[model samples]
Target: MSAHVFLHLCHEVGTSLEVGTRRDIMDIINTLANQMRTNLMMTSGSRREGFRLVESDLDVMYWPNSYRVIWELYQSHYYNNLSKELILCDGSESRPGFTLLYLLSPRLYSELQRACVRMKNRHYISSSKHRQIKCSAESQRSTLHGPCVGRHHGMLGYDLAHCFASDIWPPSASSWIDRSHSWPPSHIVDDIVKRGCHFVAIGHKLEKHEQNEWRISFSLAEQKLVYAMNHFQFLTYGLLKLILNRIINNGLGDDDKLLCSYHMKTAVFWAIQQNIIPQWCPHNLLYSSLTCFKLILKWVYEGICPNFFIPSNNMFLSNIYGEAQNFLFIRLYELYKMGIQSMLETLSITSCNECIDFIRDPSISSCADEDVLFSEADFDIKLFREVDNQGSFSVSNVQKCIQFLHIIEQMIASPLTQNQDIMLQKLTNSVLQNLAFMLPLNTYTQENKLKYRADKISCHFLKFAAKFGCISDVLYLAMYYYKTFRYTEALAIIEVIKVKLSQPYVMHNFNVDEEMYTEAVGGQSWSTKMGQAVAWNIKLNNNILYISELRPEQQSSLQNDVPYLYIPPFVMLYMLEIFAANM
Candidate 1:
């Protein structure tokens, strides 16, 4: 496990696609994506960004753009009143910034459903149900021997991401609401916005519920970040992902979906943000990787993994359980201690599964003997459930809220089905009972403003339930509050939730340690301003100097260490100082 050997291995495994083959693959993927799009009338595009020669396989983002298409169909139903089944509830009127549409008519509903199925079949090439083309032995041959037809090189090897590309800014961006603070460069933000962020279709028990919401993905930004990395940084990331996907995840068990490449990507992002860039040299690659492992382990230990762009969006909100979280933390911590020596051992024992053939020969290989198509659908689709996790209300209340949500969803969609009246009545009755069970008793006097506020909040909740068919938003908002250390505000929001849903929440109370949070975040003026915005929705006053704009004298005042729960201390200081020195 000498430096020479490790470096050589890194070079061997982490090489990018050869010039010709890279071009060919891109052409094939784009052509196939376009064909599917033209034939299906849906948006489809593929980008090869995260692929590493022998280390990683063809990592493509198969964007289905389902929400946009469905949204158009929904608009048609709303304007035409095509069927009684397609009921549209304008949440914008009742609630300021939301909209929900119900699929009521079973016949028309079936049509939309059929369209969705078609989209799934045409774009969602991984699903067993949609693999009707595989029924014939002749069709299977195309997957086997053909130069352009192997799954790995062919169009079929891609992981389909049935996501929606939307122009909406992430809710976490609200932290930068105050004009006084300097945020990520305006140009960068503008570029991200122009490219448009995507939201993947993800939820728990999504099939049974009508409202399957989207989870924001900065994959486009992620690709950019990867590209921006130096050679060592790129190689380090590829190596870490290899360890996580092969050694650690395999050790956990085959069915364990707890850890994945995205988690590793998140760790890398955080590391870069923390000024670990300089540390990611060939000489220190192992150390930098250890830092990444430590960061992820810390997240696992705390049972919270912050989304790099969205501070409030916890990536591990739904996946990590009590036993699982503990096990993963211990395992990762051990790996970090073992360092490169352990990595060398793992690499030696583990099969070299990287796409070496695709890189060296530039020839498409087939997996004809394979019984199953390995896809990321399972991990890619589960959106983090919004739950008031910071001990605001009882977990049972939260669970009840989620249950009531399904009832409300069914109630709303019932009218669109054949048994409209009967189903609606039954669902309505069931919803009322659940609501009664969940909502607080009317105790305030008429003179009390609390009573009126409660009524208003209740109205908003009911309307929202009708729209989205769930109270997950309430949970997510509460979590956001908790993450920002606004415990009181978080509890206040939770109290307004008129449902008894139960789930795991942060047991510990958040202390508004302003200094700690600011230091951890880095960029003094921006950090202070962001804190102010979170505490009180103040206008973003342009009063502070970002690290990039800081003078030598100002650098002395930069918070070098922060105690924020999300990112480690000193990271902010490192980032600020590094930027200042470079500038």
Candidate 2:
């Protein structure tokens, strides 16, 4: 490579090193090997095989292929070069080729990630069955296992230098990164934060003559600047994240998290000035990702993080959901989806979908129509009031709430039964038969809310839920909304209630005629006595229907100690109407 041409490549990759810079560094590194006599033959290609260092990125192919030499090169000279650092690649084994894939700048990376996702899900409809049924005189698997299913295994993006700074790959356990290259930049700090200490110091140490001459204005906060200087090798792409991981995992300081975040945030600002980052990662997508990475972590993991620049979890999700929604980055979207799914399933939260749907919806915005949002400000104010009364919330609390919404939506969309749906249904039915006469109690506080004021809360949320197409919360919330209205809210609630009453539930009903009607022996409010009667019927006939309650010994009073009967809110309401009509 000519001296001028090398400078051009360096410029294209947005770094200071000219062509000779890398060769000088490499020749020295090769000399470090005890057996430096081995001839070094280098071939570069763009194809995803062998070893090719794209643009100015440094990648070299080794004969008698082993990863150990590359590791040695990385461990020895990666920090020293201050030019091209390592971003590992898992080379193709059968093809016997290596390629250095330059990390795409942010917008491009985000764009590519999205493209890959669409590619991944192109066949979902044909891939998944709507429902399953056993074979009708067909051999099971034709004496062969069914074809393996294809799944989407996505890509990770990082800064080359950041990735290669470590001895081993960061996010090794969580990130399915290729191990051949040597650099890393975690867009989300926590993604690689657990491995922070390992890469704490990786930068070009100033030479004696240059030490005094290198007047560094140093923009990022001290900690961020320090971490970024080392991790990013004075690059912008992955500095913020590397710094954040250190703060979060190692603790930025003994007492002050804000101060720590400020320090890092300032460092990012300074790094931006040093390198537009756009040249290497246009749109600063890595930074954008890192910007919300903390919230993304919180949204996905449901916890506050040191990376978020603030420790509060209150609006962390709202902020994260906005970024994920705005960027619509597949990597982020998938994380949020997974997070939401886990959160709701684990928390068993059945409400809040309206809020989630609203937030996740690309159309609605709490920030947009100030008049509308402000008119709704009182609602937020009230919500804050409620927030205030509750104990201080941490990151996990928000995760639980967000997860609850996600799970409810998923269940409504896709109901699963054990390993086998048909077989599971039979088991579910048998359990119903085995444990009837028990009324289920609310497990989460929201479930109790389903019991206590299922009407009001449901009514407020019903329309919005339906608009967002979240039928689960819509139907469930509408039931309570209808039940609790003062004549008007009640009437309004019930109007929508009719549409959702028959959607679906475990204890589905049919005509109850002479077979079900029994002469009543005692005076009871129809709903109460009906509850008890139904409870008894389920216990005797459908054993799986259950309600939990205080044991008689633990009861505050005998009269108040009746075992609760539990049913889906919609189901309970449906039964209540049946009794009224019968009466």
Candidate 3:
């Protein structure tokens, strides 16, 4: 096979355009979901950057909506008389890529005040103190790792970095605008700069008052740049990451972190911007990878890995220098000399021989048949699981649900692609179900006539929910009927639920018989498959609106730390059936 064909095969094995599209869609869905919450707005980081690598970690940066950071004193005028607390970024006392956040607002949140230390008549938020406060509030399982609060155990282990949003672009990174030149285009640059940046609670390693300084994060800009990359560029980036994880960092202890994935990204970014390769195409893919690796090796040798935005900020100063840097340089240099073939061989893709065979024969398909299907199923399962976990009936929850419903309505009224329409329907289903369970709670304290009217309205909402919700969602209506002493009506619903649960394709608690599911609903639309899904557990919010019979169970759950009680669907159904029989 020619080198061009080999590179194309590598692209096929390493990257999926379909997966990238789905990831972008998932990011939008997550962004919409985060908008409903008042406390924090989340932006997904590395994991959602259109990559399907197994080594990718779930990196999320979330900032409070009530706080805003300004890069300059003059920029504060933009938020004059606003309710949000203003924080000024003061880089005079810090490094190039980091600044001390000075609290400009006289009225500060108590938590923010606690994280502030007065120095020279200015109160600066201490990154260390802020991290300490955040860690204290988190569960025991969570530990502070640099700026992020990392939880190591989960379906997808995540690193949550609590950051502050800044609407003004930093002056230090102004040079990046003109530096783009031919690549990324002017529109992409403009959009990225307009979106601004975030300040994470990490200081430059060499800063004297590290705790008082915050690092300016260009994660938003980087994400935009990644999105703007062509397929070949993206595949090359993915390939670099694979090499970083599988080749360079392999068997290295945690303390020996001389090189990181960020270095690889920066190398690629520079390579693209400098036009190191005249063309980025399948034929030139190996050349592209080689150029990036060469750049990284040179940076390591020089002991200066420049930050993409701020060139003066050396990323290698803290860890990648001296003896460590020399060792990394030698290792990378050896690999660079061995060339692209060595790097390709080190990739942990399934069966090297199979990849080689596929490359030799043009007729052999290199793509996985079930890649798209599995990706869709995975996305749906995770999204729905999040909905299930957060389901609650409270005053605040009701308000959020109402807001989310309004957003969904607005989105539905606009023009949408097929995937977007399906996404909105799933969101609508979740919000409607939340409203159904929550809206009637207020009527419990009202007069009998009002309560009767509320019960009727609640039933109507439940019916609407059942249309879009999973199969077990109807059980909410049955539970409501049983609560109202309508045993016959509840029993009828229970019988129907039993029959549905008996189906081999039914999924519950994030578990499904794979063969049965694939045979039954694998080819169906997400909405269609979800309509047949079953809720894993019946969640009852800790509220006084529960039926008298269930109050004991609710009270027991309240004694624990959690704000809700989780009853398996079958368990709840059996208990309700027995109670109805006796009643």
Candidate 4:
């Protein structure tokens, strides 16, 4: 292909406006949902930032609301006394963008105390101790990777980092404010500064007290900056990551960790901010990518990949020196000399042949259709899992239910596209299902009048959810009826679910019975088919507030930290029918 055609193909494949918008919508919804949780505030990274790369891990940072990190002593006054434990950032001994956290709270919680060590009559939280505790507290299958505890079981493995929230931006990164004048614009910069940063449980590797120091995290700020990027710039960033993972870091062992996704991100940030590429557009996509690559090569050559926020903090201080640095530099230099065509050809030869095919033809092929269906299935499964993962509603209090209702209302009031609307429908279904269970559990009273009213309301909520939910979700309503001693009503819903499951188009997990699905709804729009498609699995979130009735039978499943129980619709239908008959 000619250079013009190749660049156009690259832009078409990587810089998809539709894909970017969908990702933005997903992020907004997730961010809103995460904000409702009181105990731990979760912020999504990587994939949530509008890139739908298959290799991207689900990166999340969560911090408890009870603890607060402050830059200055005076900032403590803004927090309510006894409400939150204050941790002061002491950057004196640590490197720029890393700080020693001094426990400013008069009474340290046992967990905090355990992670703290006294130095000069003041207790400082040990990063190593804190990270150990956090990692150990997670599932045994999780492996510790720097500040994150990673679980590698699902379609998309996730890395969970436990961090401390700082309301004030770190002084070390204060230079970032002045540096963002050209690219991010004043409003974006102001928003990032106001949102501040986090302190993750990993210190500067070269620091003397590395165990007691916390590296400043710009995850939130970085996310904002990414959101601010135009499609061309975003795709350029994605292309760099593709090079890093597929070309640079390919076949490198765990210990041979040299270049990281962050390095690529920092390079992109600097490139955009510095206006190294005068115009970032489809025609200049390859040029932009090469510019970023050149910058990274220079950094690798110098053995100094500077942190974008704090340029003084050399990210390559720990590694990327001597033999490793030389190897990386040579590899990058060879690729650079070979030019963009060589790199594209190299990518085409990789296992991800679909990427090149996608570049060549932007239109959805038959295989792409199947992939899209599977992607939608995965998205739905993830949405279901996130609902279950959020702190469950207590049987005694319906506060969480109320909060979810508020969130649902907010989502409805906002303007949404068809895809987002469908997502909202699914979200509404999940929330209402949980609320249905919670209402019955919390309002169950001996007063016949009140009990009857609550039961009626609960049933109505379940019915509403059933309208928007998958075929399997209707079983929730059936289960609710069975639980309430209304066996006949339950059996009726079970019969409906049985009929729906018999349909050839019903999807289950990632398994796409393509021939059957195509025959059923081949000509229909994706949104139409998506609306009609029913999942085979009846997902009961393993939360006592939602599934208290199932506790007796699901004792083992509940005891473990599994988010949801995926029972086949047929099995649930039959089981509920048998139970209703016996009753």
In model 4, the Cα lDDT at residue 216 comes to 89
lDDT minimum window of 10 residues, candidate 4: 364-373
Supply the global lDDT for candidate 4: 0.72
lDDT tens digits by residue: candidate 1, 186-215: 665566655645544433222222133234
Over 4 Å off, model 4: 1-18, 21-35, 74-85, 108-110, 151-156, 348-399, 410-421, 435-454, 481-491, 494-536, 544-561, 568-583
Preferred candidate (lDDT higher): 1 or 4: 4
Q: Count the backbone clashes (under 3 Å) in each candidate.
A: 30, 55, 0, 1
TM of each candidate vs. truth: 0.43, 0.18, 0.79, 0.79
**TM-score of model 2 vs. true structure:** 0.18
Better of 1 and 4 by TM-score: 4
Q: Which is better, 2 or 3, measured by TM-score? A: 3
Clashing pairs in 3: none
Candidate number with greatest lDDT: 3
Which stretches of model 1 miss by more than 4 angstroms? Answer: 1-6, 15-47, 50-156, 173-189, 204-211, 251-253, 349-583
Q: Please list the Cα RMSD from the true structure of every candidate, rounded to 1 decimal place.
A: 26.7, 27.3, 5.1, 5.5
Candidate 3 lDDT, 389-505, residue by residue in tens? 333323346767778778778777877655566666655654565566566544343467777776777788778877777787777788878777789998999999998877877
Candidate 4 local lDDT, 14-53, one digit each (tens): 3354445456456656656575766565556666676556
Tell me the whole-model lDDT of each prediction, alpha carbons only: 0.41, 0.27, 0.73, 0.72
The candidate with the higher lDDT, 2 or 3, is 3
